[model samples]
Each structure stands twice: as structure tokens, then as C-alpha cells.
Target: MLSLGAGVQSTALLLLAAEGVLPRLDGAIFSDTGWEPEQVYVHLERLEKEVATPAGIPVYRVSAGNIHTDALDPAHRFASMPLFVKNGDGSVGMIRRQCTDEYKLKPIKRQVRTLLGYPAGRLPRGLFAEQWVGISCDEFTRAKDSGIGYALNRHPLLELGWSRTDCLRFLARRGWQSTPKSACVGCPFHSNAQWRQMRDHQPTEWAAAVAFDHAIRSGAARGNATGSPLLGQAYLHRSCVPLDQAPVDTVTAHEWRERQGSLLDLLDPEDGPRGCSPWTCRSDDHDAESAVAA
Candidate 1:
């Protein structure tokens, strides 16, 4: 099965499999965080209706819970996101991230087990699934073992000597030119350009992101319910400020250089080029700090 993120690389992988370039896959599994950009869901629908269905490859959508709602529910034990925190001493840090494990990986794993014909929490010995990931050649470091014995990770993109640029070019030739990076709308790893695009083009999603940023300022709602509030304030923007007031419109020198790459090399400065995958999260690069301790 392919771990379909519906992003450029993963989409390319799915198409390649459908075209018989790669080994046929049983299906593609999408682990929804429920806070992804609107485009991601639209693209997934198109991929299913326009490609996967015609090719007889099933696409599965599974979710543990709504991340946006869980974070704000006072009675819920909200799994912390890697939110940027500003301490009293003016130092910046991040809350440890557990969202990927809870919202992405766990649900996908459960589905995998179900597909393998085994009951939850009780997989017998000598059972495994070949899980395909979409890590390209340029980002080979992101390729990792599946950690669990039931699933073995595979990277068809790297085996094909493809890179992010190659994926973009392939998709563009097929008339899929506007593929957006798949990620949660309120992901703190968003670069200035991404945030600006959301604010300018996707106003509704931008408003929701801003509202979520404000809601998490005092940390997870559960922290308040448990009578152990966060030590510092949380912010979705790395500037440690409210999302609506963030410097999204400003382009930094690093971002400028990144954009200067050939038209296909549209790499995000803060989160690198690739979007978040269930197994390989973009936040891996951003070291987590216990700044928002309860």
C-alpha cells in the first residue's frame, strides 16, 4: 500500500504505480489530520475520481480525530503540536509534538492492520505489509524504517532516481500544475510564502488558522481544565505572535534565494520543500523544546 499524502511526491508515486512504472499497489491510504488545507482534499478527490478509480486502485481515507477540535476541547487530552512558544524571558522554543503520532501514524497503522486481516492490538507473528513512502532522491535522508514489525517501508521514488523537481515536472507534463503542498492549515512550519498564499487566496482557511492560533495562545484547552496552564504562550507563526499579525507578507533573503531556483524548485524556506507525511513529518527538522510545559 502507498502512504498517499496527496502532495507532489506522493501523487507522482500514485500515478506512476497506476501507469505501471512501479509495482502495482493494493491501494493508497490517506491519513487525514482534519486541519489540512482545502486544496489537499480537493486534489485527493480528483486523484480518486480521475485516476485511481479508473485504474482500479482504491484510496482509503482514515482519521483518528479532528486535530483542530481536539486541541480546543477542554475535556480532551489534546496531543501537543510543535507550537512556537514565547517564554517570559523573551526566549523562543516549542512544545513537544505528538500530533503526528496520534492523528497521522496511529490511524494509518490501524488501517494497515485491518487491511492485513488482523484485529487491532493483536497481530500474530510473521505478518507484514510492504508500505510505500514517497521520499524522493534529493530528500533520501527522510527515508526511514517503519519501526513496527508489521509494516516495512519502501521508497519507490528514490529507487527511480527521482527528486522533488522531477516529481513537479512529471506532474506538470500531465497537466497537474497547481499541486499544493499537503499540510495542516495551522502548521507552524509554514513559511512566509505559504502563509501569504493562504491569507491572500484561501481566506476562509486563513481565518480558521488565525482563530486556532489565538485559541492555543494559552496552550491546549486541557491544560486549563487540569489546573496546570502552560508556562509560556503558544503561537502558530514562528514570530511568536498572533497569526493575523505575523510577517507573512515579508520575504526573507533565504526565501528569495529558494524561489530563484528553476521554476520547479519551489521549496518552502521554513519547512523545506516536501509536505508532512504520516511517517516522516516536516517538523523533524525543527527540534522540539519544552517551552510550553504545564
Candidate 2:
């Protein structure tokens, strides 16, 4: 099973498999969060028609639910994704992230089991599925185990000695260079540059992100850490301001002063260049203590 994230590296991996440069795959799975940018869906459609079809491979799409609706529903208060939040003391802290687990990995796993002919909630002992992830040599640190005994993680890109740059080159060579990063529109892991790109090039998505940011401002009524009634606000932008009004247009020295000693300060000037999938939020790099990605 290949985790088809619809991003550069994953797309390159699928293309390579289609070209018969790698072993045939059972199938590819794309776990939709239902909030990804429109371009991602467009790219998926292109791949389904041009690549997956001629390759004789099937691409299965699965979703647990609409994360946007799940997070905002008054009846069920799911924890907001680990977005950047400004504190009353002028500090910033990130909320704990559970979105990837709930929205990505679980659904893909469930679908993989069903594809394997396992009955719901019943798995034979020692069932190990070789799961291929698209992480390349550039993000080798992000390579990780499946963490469950039922699946084994595999990295074909790493074995091929491909870096992210190589993946881009491959796409360019194939005249399919427009593949966009795969991420939820409202992901707090976005850097100022990423936010600006959305606001400038993708206005509708930018509006949705801003709305989602405002929606999560008051902590969820049910699943927050306090486990009590809400008491604070949340902001998706590192500046702790509304996404539309945030200073994503420019990063000033004064803004740097305030962000000093904060998690955002330690991040690379931009977010990781790839989209995130289950088991790899990439937002964990918000912590200064977290391992750096190459």
C-alpha cells in the first residue's frame, strides 16, 4: 500500500512505479482531510486520469470526516489542530495536534484493512502490510515506523537516493511541474511566506483559512486540555492575529523581537517545502526541541 499524498515526492514515487522503475504496488491510498487547497484536488484528478490509469494501478480515496466541520460543530468539540496561539503574556504556544491522527492515518488504515479483506474490527494475528511512504532522502528524519504491529513502513524514495530537488526535477522533466503541496488550508504550520502565497495566489482558500482560524479562536467546548469550559483564544498565524490581518506581508524587526525565545523564531524562514500526511504533521518542528528536518 502506498500513501499517495498528492505532493511532489509522493507523485514522483507513483510515477516511478507507473514507469516500471519500481515494483508494482497493490494500490495507493489518499486520505482526504476535506480542507485541502483546490489545486490539490485538481492534481489528484490529473493523476487519476493520466498516471494511475495507464499504470494499471488503483487509487483509493478515503476520509474519516470533514475536519473543518468536525472542529467547528457545537455538538462535538474536537481539539483544534496544533495552531500557533498568542498568549496574554505576549508569548506563543502551539495547541496539541491530533488532527493528523484523527483525519489521516486512521481512515487510511481502516481502508487498507478493508482492501485486504479483513472484517471491520477484526484482524488476523501477525498481519503485516508493507506500507510505502513518499518521504525522500531530504526528509529522512521524518521517515518513521508504522507504529502498529500490523503494518511495516517502507521508503522507496530514500532507497532510490532521491531528494526533494530530484523529485521536482523529475516532475519538470515529465512536463508536470504544477503539482502543489498537500496540506489543509488552515494548517497553522504555514509560514509567513506560505500564508502570503495563499492570500496572493489563492484568495478563496485564503478566505476559508481565515474563517477557520476565527472559528477555532475559542477553544473547543469539549475536547480541550482543561476539559472544562473554554477560557482563551487561538490564532492560526504566528503573530496571534487574524489570518487576513496578520502581518504575513512582511516580517519586521519588531515582530522578530517579540518572537524571540518563541517556537516560531526557531523555525526555518519557511515551512517545510512539502505537504504533510498522517504520521508526519511537520508542525511538531514548532517546538525548539524537536529534531530539524533537512
Candidate 3:
């Protein structure tokens, strides 16, 4: 089970596993993207100490890296880059967006494969372990038969017909605390509300993101071998404007709402409350809408 904080689908899976519904809930993993919210870090600690530890389940730490103890510490995380860069005419184009492949998917698959004794370059011809993903009932389309290796892909929430609400109810029954949706603090998937939360509660992080963004004005300009930068540069907080420049309580224009809603619809017409977690969201996904009361 791979969890990004207390998100609904994963939480529900944890509950079901503990109650013997799934039976063999062997590995519990987390992919720390280095820029997660402080609240998420706090909640992960509480979760690890109280419930996860007592359950005797090993919660594997498959992280990209941190500033203090970084391991190759790539500049891009799953949330930092978009898979497809659209042309000015709104047509899709190919761009280098391997954040998910690098930070989330690769590390996880490597760990699982290693445990199965087929680390890399070859598939385990005999192993048949199931690697569970937390995509909900509504997100079954994103569930594909991608890799052909040791473990089979399992989607318990989708099979059980449970929505995000069912997951939350199960968590509340266990007296667990709900934290913010898991993604990097400067995640490009963040909505205006999530961004505002970072700016208000975590000023230093917000500032660091803003400066890091400003340092790389254009797209490739700031990054390697890409273009130079974006037009006004690319800020993590959206608005293209600086993080400090974006108002916390800024009301969305009607046009902005329509455009944003349309984008969400493109990703999944049924998006509600929160967007899909990085673990389950499609690499092609670009929706930034959220549960913030507009």
C-alpha cells in the first residue's frame, strides 16, 4: 500500500487490510517528494508511531531526497512538472515530464521488484505478488495493465466500489486525523487554495519556491537543456505572478472557473473534493482544481 498522507482511497485500503478484508497487506510505502507540507510530515510521524508501527507493517520510505540528506536529489518531483506542454493554440505537445517516473514510480517499482528478487532488467517469471494501488472507483480508467513484471496490479477501492467518502469514514472510525492532500508544497497540481495555505502557514517554504521559480525565468532557461524559461517565468504557485503577489482570498473570475472546470472535466468528469493523489493520478493529468470553496 502506497500512501500520500491520509488521502481517502489509501486510508480505506489500510482499514480494509487491517480488518482482514484484503488479508495480506504486506508492504506499506510512502514516496516523500521533499516538498510536502509541514502538516503532512507531522501527520506521517503520528501515523507511523501510533497505528502503522503497532500494526507490525513495515512502512517503506522510498523518497526522492531532502536538503540535509539528499540522495541525487533531482530538481523535479511528480508535482513539479507537467507531462504534456500544450501549444499556444491549446494543442498538446510532448515535453519532458518524468517527475512521476523518477521520484514516485521508479523507486517504488525498484523496491518492490528487489523484494521479489527481480530487481531490474528482468521480470520475475515465478513471482506473483500483488502491488496495490489506491485509485478509487471513479478513477478506474487510469488503472491500466502497464508493466509486465513480478507483481500484479491491484485496486481494492475500485473493486469494492468505495468512494473517497467511504475511505474517510473508515479512518474517522479508527480515530485517525485527516491531513492535507499529499503532494509537494510547491506542487504544480496545487490549487489556489492549497497554494495560499503554503503562503500563509509556511512562509519560508513559499518564499523559497517563489525564489526558486524566479531564478529560472523561462522554461528551459531555468531548467537544463530545455528552453530558456517561460514567458514571465514559471512560478510553482500558479498565477504566473510571484507567490507574494497572489492574494490569498482572491476570488476566481467566472472565466477562470469555467476554464479550470473544463480542464478538470478533461482529466475526469467526476472530480470532487480533492484531486487524485500523485501515486494514482495519470502521468498525463494536468487538472489543478481542488475542494477549496470557490
Candidate 4:
């Protein structure tokens, strides 16, 4: 099974399989967070028409409900994404994210199990499924073992010596020139440039993100496992202000100069550079806790 993220690299991987450059896949799985930009869904349709159908490859989309509600739902008590949080000490931090695991990985695995005729969470002895992830050569460090006996992770792009730039170039040659990065609509991992693009080209989504930013100021009711609200306020923009009013359009001269190598650069936070899957979220990295909110 191949994971189709609908981003450049994963899309390229799917195309490669369709063209017989890689192993023919049983099908591709898309784990939607349910808050992806509209363009991603559109791209998925285009892929289905132009690639998946022609190749006789099926594309399956799975999700554990919409993440927006799942995070805020009091009954589930799932912690909301740690976008950008404002602490009482006047400093900002990001919440430790659990969304990818809860929303992305688990559902995909469940579907894979169903397809393989395994009972819920039960696998036959020594039976394993080979799963392809889209990590590229430049992101080789993000590659990881599946760590589960039921699934084994593979990175074909890395083996092919491709990078994100290579994937973009390949897609451009195939007449897809504007493949955007894959991510949820309200992902705090987006850079200022990404936010500006959303505001200018996708106003409706930007507005939704702004409202979401506002709604999380007190954090989710289930932010803590114990059902307590967060100690800090949440904001989508790194400035600790509302998203609409945040300085997403322009970076100050000081900010531009300082942001280049600073830890606060939200555009390419850890687990980014490429879109993330549960295996590559880097949430386990101890340093991410200390990094400034995106």
C-alpha cells in the first residue's frame, strides 16, 4: 500500500507506480485530517482522473471524523493541535500535537487491516503488510521503521535518490506546475508566506483559520487528559494576536534578518519540509517542546 498525501512527493510516487517505474501498488491510502485546503481535495480528484484510474489503482480516503470537531469535542477529550500558544509569562509555545497519530495513522492502519481481512487490531502471526511512505532523499532523516509487526514502511523516493525539488521538477514536466504542499487548513506549521498565500488566494479558508484561532484562545475543553483547559491561551499566528490581524503579509526588517536561522521560523518547522504522516511528525523530539510556537 502506498500513502498518497496529495502533495508533490507523494503524488510523484503515485505517478511513478502508475508508470511502472516502481512496484505496482494494490492501492493508495489518503489519510485526511478533514481540514486540508480545498486545493488538495481538487488535486486528489485530478490524480484520480489522470493517474489512478488509468493505472487501475484505487485511491481510498480515510479519517477519524473532522479534526476540528474531534479536537474540540468534549466527549473525545482529544487535545487540540498546539498551533501557537501564549503563555502567562508573556512567552509563546506550541502545544504538543497528537492530531497526526489520532487522525492520520490509526485510521489508515484500520483500513489496511480491513482490506487484509484482519479482525480489528488483530494480525495473523508473522503476517505483515508493506506500506510505502513518501519521504525523499533530502528528508531521509525523517525515515523510520513502522515499529509495528503488522506493517513495514518503505521509502521509494529515498531509494530512487529523489528530493522534494526533484519531485516538483518531475511533476512540472508532466504538466502539473502548481502542486502545493499538503497539510491541514489550520496547521500552525505553515509559514508566514503560506498564510499570506492562503489569505490572498483562498480567503474563505483563511477566514475559517482566523475563527479557529480565535476559538482556541482558552484552549480546548479537553486540552488536558484530565479534562482541564490549557494554562495558556492559543493563537494561530505566532505573534500571539488574532490570525486576521497578524503580520502575515510582511515580515519586519529585523524579523527577516533574524528569522533566517532562528528557531522561530514557522514555515519549515520540524516534520515539515515535506508534509507529515504519523510516523514522521517528530513530536517525540524533546527539542520541539522548547521550540517557539509556529
**Which wins on lDDT, candidate 2 or candidate 3?**
2
Among all candidates shown, the one with the greatest lDDT: 1
Clashing pairs in 1: none
**Local accuracy by lDDT, each model:** 0.84, 0.76, 0.55, 0.75
197 Cα displacement, candidate 2 (Å): 0.6
* TM-scores vs. true structure, each candidate: 0.92, 0.86, 0.73, 0.85
Ranking of all candidate structures by their lDDT, best first? 1, 2, 4, 3
Best by TM-score: 1
User: Which scores better on TM-score, 2 or 3?
Assistant: 2
Better of 1 and 3 by lDDT: 1
| Candidate 4 structure quality by residue, lDDT tens digits, 44-142 | 999989999899999999988888877666677564575777789987788877788788888888888888889485678988778998888866888
lDDT of 1 by residue, 96-125 (tens): 889999999998898999999984777888
lDDT of 3 by residue, 137-209 (tens): 6556667653755657777788889755556556666775353456655455555555566667778878776
RMSD (CA, Å), candidate 3 to true, equals 6.5
Candidate 4, position 67, lDDT: 83
Model 3 worst lDDT window (10 residues): 264-273
Name model 1 segments beyond 4 Å from true. 266-272, 284-294
Off by over 4 Å in 4: 222-227, 250-273, 282-294
List where candidate 2 sits over 4 angstroms from the true fold.
77-79, 221-227, 251-272, 288-294
Which 10 successive residues of model 1 have the least lDDT summed?
285-294
